[model samples]
Target: MRLYKYYRPDFYFEKSLRYDEIFFASNEQLNDPHDLVIKPYFGNNKEAWKSILKSNAPFDTWCLSKIVDIDNDNLTRELNDEFEGVVVDDSSSISSVLDNQSASLAQIFEKYLTPQCNAMFKKPEAASAACVQFLKEKLARGWDKRYYSCSFSKNPLEPQMWAHYGGGFRGCVLIYRGLSDGSINLRNNIYISDSQNFKFADVNYQDKDKLVDILDLNSRVNIIEQNLLNKSSFWSHEKEMRLLLSESFGSIRVSIASGMPKSTKTQIFHHAPDAIEGVIFGSNCSESYKEKITSMLAEKYSFLLPAGVPAFLTFDSRLTSQGKVEINYGAKCIIREVRSSQVIKEILENERLNTMLKELGIPQFN
Candidate 1:
């Protein structure tokens, strides 16, 4: 069986450069081209090289060093000539010397670069053609009917055999199996899993336009997921917290209160009927009290609410001897000392709050 190997660019370059540099340096001694070995660095090995390079040298420098052999006298002189030529060629233009250096480096790498150094490292022999072909045909049928067995045992097929049929089939099969067992969820519309990891969306059968659209959507989803994850590790912690909080609290109530005028609140509710089950315009509140309410609302809903939700503003009233103005939402009650016009606008327009209203199965609008 013929074995095929895949390496990430960094790994390929790292090994290729190390081998290429050693080969170039050796060639300087022996004046002959030595055949370099190409090996497939798979799984953990690929990641290991990245960790090494990240801690040692910056990745680009390490790869470039192998190609250029900057210390070599002949190569160095050639680079110098190229740099001087680029400088003179664009002397009248506004281009800086940095551009010349970049062009010179490109030329040097083109002439002297060798195949990857790690190409010498061999990947394991894959399954033969006969072994993987059946599996591939089976998986192409779609996930629901793909597998006959539910046992998590590995099929005796070899990797090379699967590769011969086509790449990614085996991985897809494993993924499908995972999805079936509830170990994984296949979110077809989004290329990323709920866990925020990427899946190689099917591209081979898609036409150019459809493929481009899918890729673009996937890229957007990835960016949004990454931003959410970075800003707050909230989603990751949410599941555990939900379980814990569920045990302690019989009900979770989300309160939407604003010091804004009743008209603005009515407008927001008209637009974002999904944000809250009910909106309450506090009759009277102080500036400090209103600020506190706005801050709390922003904290709870800022990450939870999707984009397009407007900001709430402070209302015109001030707190009297009553200390707090109270309004009752079906799920929770809110108290505040001041309300703003903008705050009412935001409360009425938020879709998430509207969705919360639906979830409660609340039939009447107060």
Candidate 2:
């Protein structure tokens, strides 16, 4: 899993300058990089984009940060870099699906069922009409075969990340944050179980060129707005939410996304979720910070917690002598089946037994 995390130059520089700053807590201005709104810098306006890029100087910086590398010496090496979404556009996940037939991602799995999928097919397939036509016929028959199980990310609030890139693209991007914890960085493993979060159109769009087209700004914005505006999608989302609680156990994800209403005359938006799964805090986090967040979640989002929603907290000096940390995402609950409470029980015992006895001043008894 060679995952690369993207960071704006300014965010990266700030992290470097203040190594222990807990940057996620700060109220400084932050943009949804993938769906940013920099005035005339909207859509594919090349001149405005160029100006924004020039202002950003080194542009965006991506780092080779793997869970394995988090504790290694190489993690400290700072990178200086451009194209906030260059790596994302060139992602092999996106390319492989189009190139590999086994993926079957070329087909629209469903129609008008999802406004996002409908708007995608409505686009002119310019450079790859053959692929588009094939998809249209395949989808017209109401193809229901699973086209993909992949990751996608966007402004969880405004999903325009791929609007200009031929629309109906989906995957969990490297960055995602709820309004509650929107400050977490690329180091976090942001995964999405698309089973309920998204529906890939059953159309196979093979022309990478067409998929990469810089669409009209208005068109791109409209596609995103349509996704939000799809009242049917929200109904489906509500059903999925109820079904998730009824059918799932162990780990899950709960996301609060910004949705558009069904009316074209009004622009009011509301918050909803795509669900949540196993989540762990970054090792750089402070204990007090952890407590504050846990308290907030318990108070405001208690309904989201399942039988055992796990929390992975970084250790304070009181826990160990050397501060060595082992990120336990291998049991991420997504990749492998997490069957029991053994892992959680073990963690609690390791973190509490000795402290309990010492604090109570109990005699060592066999």
Candidate 3:
């Protein structure tokens, strides 16, 4: 359950190490325009549509209840007139259904249905279309609700990740140890979710578009999966996972002009220093940035030392003679090197990592 975030050697990278924070971007700010977009399919699942109409669900609270508030008698008359000649197998429930009807259906129709789905309701002999309209509207409600997320990868040594996210080996990767429950510790200011408001899901890659069949039970049940967890196969190489924060929960808020659309943009979230395992500097990473990382880890070393956690070792990547990348603990860069606190104290004393540690006052390992 280790996660890695990639960053270029820039202000953001320095800020993250200094403040122990990460940023979550809204869908609008994400690299992929199509990300989090769902194309709903309203197919021939009559039974699914019927279940939605019959169940006392969220739809009943928002869609049906809103319709019912619009003048109950009018709703009853309109429903009866629309279905009058149509033959229903169970005529007994029809009266109850009529009594439950409310308000001018036209108002709710205009408020909910998109232009395409609205057209479906305008056709004659489209009683089933009405149900499809409502079901699609309910399923698509997630689109309007904003979600903020930061992405990570299961693989830390992926070359593509280095090239794409690491500014072509000039950047660095921050590795974190998961909590006891194997969850990432991401907090916004002082607000942290004990696993209730925040969520983590591995991204699922598919060759086709991320489609949600509105009439399918599985599709309707896993709405979050359909919208957030799914990604195009083109992204499979990254082995991505996401940490999601809901708009109602996270600390970041956006204020837009009255007529402009709302946006969350980028949000900063803090992580516990102890949660950080270490950092890996890309092959082409500059010495200046490395110094910055050293300074930050030096501060965190005191906190990590007391818990008997492994020393916060630095790693560097190299291209082997065989033309493949490898991590090694050669006199230069060590990979996952664990040493006793005394050994670490001695190592720092020797300044084995050049003058950077000595300059940063890292010898205070105690």
Candidate 4:
């Protein structure tokens, strides 16, 4: 597979070309406020409450106290009145009360009883409140684990992409060759045991909201997918993909460098050298910027390809009759006569290539 990352000719582009760095944005730093937001769903009934209680007992008691203002003193008395010889297991009655009494109870329930339940109570509403609070806290704990991602697109020729991500056709798009349909090779410098190194997911654009089943304690992977892989249909134009990296569990290191002060919010990683297939400059990309980039590839970053094989470079020129950007995929390099002095100097300095030039009747420089 191939992936495209759009970039403006800015400091970030310079850093990426110099360091071969791919930056992952933290979930909180994403542009969309609703991005990664998971709407947790826990059925307001006995089964959900039972699942909650099985997870944590103390949290259950705490939720009950906060939501209904009930204490240990009145806990048993309230339980007897509400449950009425029932096993205190049938929580459906309590949920029904929460549903009718407060339409906002569902939201409150998620806030309080997010992950688990433990305490028993007299009033069904109070017990329901406690269950809600218990689960809420548990879910919050799980959600606190930090996540970061770098986005990519399947298409590079789209004009809208050029406008939005490519700085209004003045930037460029990086191309990467992947191992499979949606996978890319990304390795970090610092190792964090038990943490995910990297994973690629093709973005799924849908109109429906991502609802996480908070009652299922074993659904960690599902939660991550729902939050990261899914996007609104409005973003479907991008044909997006993502590379995700998770922070090491229980570790405080935010950047891949570890212990070093982070100068930016981005988490950097070095990609496999050969993964970089080529670069396509936008229609309005400056000639000087193109020269700088091609020079870097010709000199320091030549290791990206096999010897004698130049990395592909092309200019996305003026719009075609179809109103689509024109790109000559046959173009092998971005060399321009405007910068011919430096390029020719470097070519002539190479003994192997200079000999070839002489054989072709090219004038020899002293």
Candidate 5:
């Protein structure tokens, strides 16, 4: 259940030492190492960087893994001596390439966790659960909100692990409750794109407030992300979002939901088959949009969970040719949504640990 980890010695080494731990990466790489960084949104946004520093919202986190090879040294040497930079051409379908899901525990973590580490696990879910547990345990020991309250992807070192679909915040399921297994999806692959640099002005970050101030810079990034999404057309053909390790409706763990701007959500709701597949959080929330989300909340895409539970993004109409998935599951759904963001945020942003975890609806943090 353990994964080999890497860190940017420049940014995280010292902060992690405070907790004696490395946390999961959220949609934001500011927290921990991430894997699915599709687009590096925060790389150049300057104005948005300043706003996040002043705001107090909590951020998302992720952990990327590779199937560890027992004979890593030998295999690495072999690959180094013989590996080619190019992949052979083939007739593989994009869908097949995209559906490169691991079929078993062995296949999934084969190169991610060391052989000694992998030997202790029985299932892939267990390894995922252990990753979250490790983070939660650290929080149990207590983290400095001002410092450690920040939050990855495959390779755990791949460049994408630092990407965010062109927004500092990736619209991760945006918001959810009762269920943590479902992931967020956006159509059109649209997001706020910026080319401005927000780097510290030749100032060293060892300064007390520098690190927190730097991380705070991400606040306005989401708003900018939404604004950009608004200006672009929502492509119905886009359905690139999906969970990496999701097993079922109830595979709930350290889950995150991010709310998109109202105008952006409206376009997706009408243009895209589902605005957000399973659940969403509110931002610039409006009555009509609320109704749309509420209505979807009451319906079931298939029997995967229950009649009232919303469908996950994997079944988003944009992803399938049939327009919707009809798979039925007999299990009752425990994942649901929150109608009010203020109430949830008030609880989440507060420093009280027990109350925050309660509203999050997890026995522990994800």
Candidate 6:
């Protein structure tokens, strides 16, 4: 199981220091005998296990091999000259490349690696835990009353519940409990629904305080769950209003709903008295219906003392062939009415409009 190793003689320098006099003959000089041994573990002899005693003899002699190459002055001079030229060339090349490489490395480190490393080192989990504990402690002392109190349950269908009572407060909070094995169970049990129902048994009022503390702890857990879903984005008022209205009252179908109300028919004239540019109402009606509508328009227009006031309106009975009406008021007025139920359905289904109304501070009638 032992791995291969490449140990340079330099590694033994420190250990050999104590035996400098015997090994090197002088402290200032490093003229010690050099020995290089290559142990092959792959041949027929290598496959056979050798006794420690048999290997010890060669090992000892290998450690003290004479440094004949070092003592050769001519060979040493040639080697020195070659090495000196190589060293100078390497030094120049390295120096030239160092500035460019260092700058590139610094940019990469700052742009990519540093932020990741810093974030990795941050104690986020510990910080979150600490925050939860602090909130619990504060709540126990009755320091923060603005928060809702809730309780936790062990049921898979009901893990956490929050309770709130009137004074504009009354709802249950619930959370799914995440299991250690990466599975989750929706334990919808009330964490806290009503504060009044909770009991504090201690005579010193401390028992009641503990209930508050528990509520705070549950709130923290719920917050963590919310963070996972939303990432701290601001809530869209329009979206929330749409959900609230649509869930309760249902969508308004537009394709089938009748055209503008009869009241709107008359009001259009009053709003734009001069808008008499070929306006028509009703479809496949008798001449009597057309005459009645014409008369009504004439009477309404009689008050228009000024003529040619940009009156632009058009209508076509042919438009109703598709179960819908198309009324065109040139550049000023446009009105349409449909006979199918889908017209109303579209209006009802338009949650965005509903939400926009709510965001505009409109009060819900139902």
TM-score of each: 0.16, 0.21, 0.61, 0.62, 0.18, 0.15
Q: What is the C-alpha local distance difference test score of each model?
A: 0.23, 0.23, 0.54, 0.54, 0.25, 0.21
Candidate 1 lDDT at 276 equals: 23
Scored against the true structure, residue 240 in model 3 reaches a CA lDDT of: 86
Query: Per-residue error at 20 for model 4, in Å?
Result: 1.3
- Per residue, candidate 3 scores C-alpha lDDT tens digits across 165-200 of 988889887777765555665566735544223445
Model 5 regions lying over 4 Å from their true place: 1-278, 301-366
Model 6: residues with Cα > 4 Å off, grouped in runs = 1-280, 307-314, 319-366
- Kindly list the per-residue Cα lDDT of model 5 for residues 1-366, writing each as its tens digit: 111122332233323322222232223333212122111111322333223222222323222222233233443332222212212111111112112321332233333454444555776556544443332222111111111111111111122221232121111122222123232222222243221111111111121111111122325334322221221122212212222211111111212111111111111100122222233212222445434433333342323234333433211001123322111111112334443211111112233433433433322211
Candidate 4: where is the Cα deviation over 4 Å? 56-141, 190-197, 218-220, 248-266, 303-310, 333-366
Error of 2 at 64 (Å): 58
Which lDDT tens digits does candidate 1 get at residues 1-366?
011111122343233222211111111122112101011111212222222212222233233333323344555455334433221111111122323344444444445433442242232111111112211121111111100001111221222222322132211111011222223222212233343122211101111111111112225334322221121222221111000000011000100110111121110001111122122223322345434444544443344344423333222211233442212221222322232222333332245445543443321222
* Candidate 1 root-mean-square deviation in Å: 29.1
State how far residue 218 of model 5 sits from its true place (Å).
41
lDDT by residue (tens digit), candidate 2, 202-279: 112121222221213235433432222222222221111100001111110100001111212211111222123212
State model 2's lDDT: 0.23
lDDT per residue for candidate 6 within 18-115, as digits (tens), equals: 11100111111211111010111111121111111112222222211121122333432332232221111111122222233333323322322222
- lDDT tens digits by residue: candidate 4, 164-234: 88888888888776776456655564242232345567888887766655445567566656667888887
What TM-score would candidate 1 get against the native? 0.16
Off by over 4 Å in 1: 1-105, 108-224, 232-276, 280-366
After TM-score superposition, the amount by which residue 11's alpha carbon in candidate 3 deviates from its true location, in angstroms, is: 0.8
